[model samples]
Target: MHEKNAGQNKGERHLMMQGKLNRGPIEFKSRPAERTGAIMAISTTNVVCVPPTMSICDGVSTMTREGFRRLPITDAGSGQLRGIITVSDIVDFMGGGDRYNLVKNKHQGNFLSAINESLRSIMTEQVMTLRENDDIEDAIDLIVNKRHGGAPIIDDESGVVGMVTEHDLLKALFQGQSLLSVEDVMSGSPRVTNPDCSIAAVAQQMNKYHFRRLPVVSDDVLFGIVTATDIMKYIGSGEVFRKIQSGDVSEVTALPIRSIMTGSLQTTTPEKSINDIAREMVQKRIGAFPVTEDARLIGMITEFDLVRTLASR
Candidate 1:
């Protein structure tokens, strides 16, 4: 055992046999160049939120008015998290078969009333949230793996402050790619949507790949497309996605993917500059531009993919 004393030099006791009591100069190798590039903790303190008591219609309207995709549902008084509501959740409910059947049967009034329900009724009560001081990498991992658009950042009191999103992550890489082109970073082969396919099928595919949207393709022709937003728009009709999640593959459950898929699409070409594409995505608040070749869909360049590529460096 080594004798211990703060005043004693390190290894002094071992060197005592040599009768050298004085301390020698310490030789230190260049301490690994102050390792950097570690991600700092991210916060979500400035995120928009809604009260659970608010009607789904109101919440949805708020999301639209504020250009938000999701909102944290909080207690009115306590300001504590109660649940979360996304455009997707609302669309899932609205696009359900029962709701569509009602609309088809000349019962538009009943369909209208359904959307007036409280956010608490439709909001996901079990929300996955990040603390104000959570490591950004952790948030990125959770968001990417779980396919979340973004998550609420909660304060010490559990109140939402802001969000940490793919947009923020991608912003960090704008400087990293000085001359990379869309073709260089784009996914050469992307999962596409088939018009004849069921919405359920497409949704499952989206879930499987954590895709935000899919390019609609049929007979090697690129048509419109389906986005997570497009799906959310119909959620107020029916909870079709939920049924699809529960393993219901019947036709009634296999709602037409074409019905909800967005008809107008924004596309890019292989020769387009990556910086130009990034600017467009950021300005439009959209994820990617389907990379097309000779007016045919060839690939995609999404924020998720962009971030992944940059982070790898």
Candidate 2:
């Protein structure tokens, strides 16, 4: 997610490192006019959290079922925020290894044997949470900087309050973009997959295209969809990284996507108002929603696409 924000205009004096967007040796100062007044946006008290005792698998299920990209872990009895599990953490952990031994070991053993591991195994213990009184601008900056998609908001006595997300900010900005139908802004004939496609292969495409999700299709029929977050949940909790490390490539990559896809889909229409679509996306916290008409899947509207539209406008 370290990609460019949809609305950033690299005015001048901005130098980008080759391709990897991690800021390089460039430094500078800014004037008072640079501030966009992005603070104090989110102030909701509704949030969803997972218990520490829940299995990582079940936790993954909860997030996908509820349409969340990250889940804050809390003490079941104390209701205190513990930590968080995110797609970045999952991908980072799965992507590491001292190239030689890591790759060598993975090719010879069953890397996926550890899929049922506990949540504590992969969850980040040192979490940076919002204090409710904290400025939402800071969260916005972090998101723009590609640190996280969302931040968990906390309350007095260390209880969970709510979460502020990049999508929420995008929702506010997209309402002003030139009026257009969903089809006007959406990517039609999107890349799709089937129920039997291997998760490993699908994951590669997602990483390559920086896509969050892909619609699942079979025999020219759309049934459901899979996402990067969903893949992280599967590989992280299931200890599939262990398989990747153990060199059991064949076994780990054999698992079908149907085991993880969200079968029940929420769809939009080609003629639907983009305003209504944005509101629904913000409310649901889902990045990609299929656009259908007359019961046929035709297009996809993603948060990235929305952000790009806002940028163009």
Candidate 3:
């Protein structure tokens, strides 16, 4: 088993280092890289924005199709940042359904009618906004504490500039080499397991693979994520087992992963940036994020990964 594990580790490392080594001076540039007085030199031109009066249904649809979890809402005429929308907001609206059902038959008791009416009346003004020059940490705080997934970036002139999301923070932390998409550093194949796996077995897998966390999958669908923190939290809580004696059953041995795993999960995609990932970790007070591709678990990014990447540089 030890030899097998060693072989696996070697293979994984080889796969990771397969790319060519480029020799050059690495340049590090961040949004508001160097604060220039009250006016920050924020990257704004490439921001994606939509009209404030647009239907929420349409906005949700667009985000889902584009694999974006957040988008900025802007004024159509003045192009001013109004607010932002997120996957959480849409998920809350849909009540955790796989797909939002907006249409319904008349016999369904005004389901479609209500949805239509709501869409017609709903607008982006109801959400919040942040200034472009505002510290990125401030945005992180708002998103984590307020449960917002995205915020519209605005200039001192109150015009819409760009948008920021949790994934953006992940990108910043893991892939700091360029302003490229988050997908660049995101892992395309992640290790996953079922919640029903035995604690000992799971521990063995983690030790064997050197994984900090594993995405919990059910029927090939992502349910949530379980991390080393979760395991430690469980042990620390002492709700499972207090003490063990010789010939006695350890409390942890009898526990199931689902009993202690965190149900509320925050995730990201491959298209985010490393700086964004780092910002997210600081803001959300989380140590890691499960990276996904098309809603499928692919890889994970953690504080350790960021530290290792930085050390390598």
Ranking by lDDT: 1, 2, 3
Check candidate 2 and list the clashing pairs.
Answer: 106-245, 106-246, 106-247, 107-247, 111-242, 111-243, 112-243, 115-238, 115-239
Each model's lDDT comes to: 0.61, 0.60, 0.52
Each model's total of backbone clashes: 26, 9, 25
Name the 10 consecutive residues with the lowest summed lDDT in model 3. 10-19
User: Candidate 2: which stretches are off by over 4 Å?
Assistant: 1-40, 43-85, 88-108, 112-164, 174-178, 235-252, 293-296, 311-313
TM-scores, one per candidate = 0.65, 0.56, 0.42
lDDT of 1 by residue, 210-285 (tens): 5567777765677766787766655433543344432322433357777766546888876666667877777787
- CA lDDT for candidate 2: 0.60
Report the lDDT tens digits of candidate 3 across residue range 191-290: 6667776554455555555454677776556778766545544433444334333312233444566766865888887657666777777677676787
Order of quality (TM-score) = 1, 2, 3
Candidate number of the best TM-score: 1
Q: What lDDT is reached at residue 189 by model 1?
A: 62
Best by lDDT: 1
The alpha-carbon deviation from the true structure for residue 275 of candidate 3, after best TM-score superposition, in angstroms, is 2.4
Query: Which regions of candidate 1 deviate over 4 angstroms?
Result: 1-46, 95-110, 178-181, 194-210, 231-264, 271-275
By lDDT, the better pick of 1 and 3 is: 1
